[model samples]
Target: MEITGNKFALIGLGDFGAHLAMVLSEKGAEVLAIDQNMDNLEEVKDSVAHTVCLDATEEKALMSQGIDEYDAVIVCIGDEFEETLLVVTVLQSLGVKRIIARATTPRHAQILRHLQIKEVILPAVDAADRLANKLLFQSKLSSLELSSDYEIIEVDAPDKFVGKNLRELELRVHYDVSLITIKRIELKPRLLGGTREVEHIIGIPSPDTVIERGDVLMLFGKKESVQRMMAD
Candidate 1:
């Protein structure tokens, strides 16, 4: 759980926000906890790097803290939908590098999607562990837990594994893991004079398919075995 040297800003220090901030800090991330309520700030002041009591909806207040420079900003307001939307809008206007907002309802989530917010989360489903994993596991884009011990995760190709093929890697025999598939990036030319990179999964990869630099490897295995493979 220890992820080193990542910095994050957590807005709205409610129960969910407070727990997430503490978990991130415990996992070696520098967290700035922000909220309008002084009590919320006081609760996590000792746990995080810095705590600020300010109205997140105010663009000036958000700018004053230089949240744009953080690795990511998480808006964790759950009760007031308007306030959450306003805060998210202000954050968007301010051009914060990355924003992850909490959606209380399906409608709220849909609205966030309309805003083109890539990461909209529900506090009820996305608890501390998931959020922590999202923020900490930069290489691990997503994961699905099948049981207490087994899971599937999509991870970026490791540096050491940039050029090798599956047969050479011997993933199953050596690491006790299975390569589900590979998500490779290819440029799709647009109608106008532009080409944008798109990710598509190379279904059921053969042993000869070589791993590339930007390839996302879908791996399935026991939790401990997966961790061991990544560490190795």
Candidate 2:
């Protein structure tokens, strides 16, 4: 998360925005947090490099702060779409290089697109999609957004492949996919109950590494390639 030499301006000091600012600061980025609410500003005063109390819709106040110099700006206001749009417009007009906005609904996202906002995030919708996929698939596969055509997935190890070495399977050549990580799990039970241990294999495993039952593998490649691999 440490983005060296990156300066970020976060508008809005709500829960999401405040947490983002803290993360960015922890990652070695200089974060400037802005909010009209004095309480919000006070809450994150010590978390970020700078905390300012100002209406983000006010162009003059924003311009006075020289936010244009920052590398990136994120608009995290959720409730007021008008204020969000105004802030995005003002930031774009000020020549901000990269602007990322959070939108609540699809309609709001469309408005941001019409204004030519480069990045719009719908966290709730995306989370719901992930959750739904997890429940329906029940195959340990999770959602991945790589591109219009390609996707990465994480899934439990296939039953047939268990106890086999990577070299014997030839995953990359045969399936056109790459394993990224092996997720391992270790369980500790109470003294009264017997203990159990579980591990999930993931990623491009070493050729010598042995695949076991109940392991999880994180794979990355084109969707078609991934499907072919899983089928094999």
TM-score of each: 0.60, 0.59
Query: Could you give me the TM-score of model 2 versus the true structure?
Result: 0.59
Instruction: Compose the digit string of candidate 1's lDDT tens values, residues 1-232.
Output: 1123499999999998999899999988999999999998899999999999998988999899998999889999988989988998999999897888888865777788778776777555435434554475544444443776777877788988889999999999988999999878675542332233445668898999899987888888887887788899
lDDT of 1 at 184: 80
Runs with alpha carbons beyond 4 Å of true place in candidate 2 = 1-5, 132-138, 141-232
Q: How many angstroms is residue 106 displaced in model 1 relative to the true structure, after the best TM-score fit?
A: 0.8
Instruction: Assess candidate 1 and give its TM-score to the true structure.
Output: 0.60
- Candidate 2 residue-wise lDDT, 145-227, digit = tens: 46776666777888878889888988888887887776655453422232223332344568887877556777778878877
Report, for every candidate in turn, its global Cα lDDT versus the true structure: 0.81, 0.77
What C-alpha lDDT, on a 0 to 100 scale, does residue 171 get in candidate 1?
94
Candidate 1, pairs of clashing residues: none
Evaluated at residue 180, the lDDT of candidate 2 is 72
Q: Model 2 Cα displacement at 43 (Å)?
A: 1.3
Question: Total clashing residue pairs per candidate?
Answer: 0, 10
lDDT of 2 at 93: 82
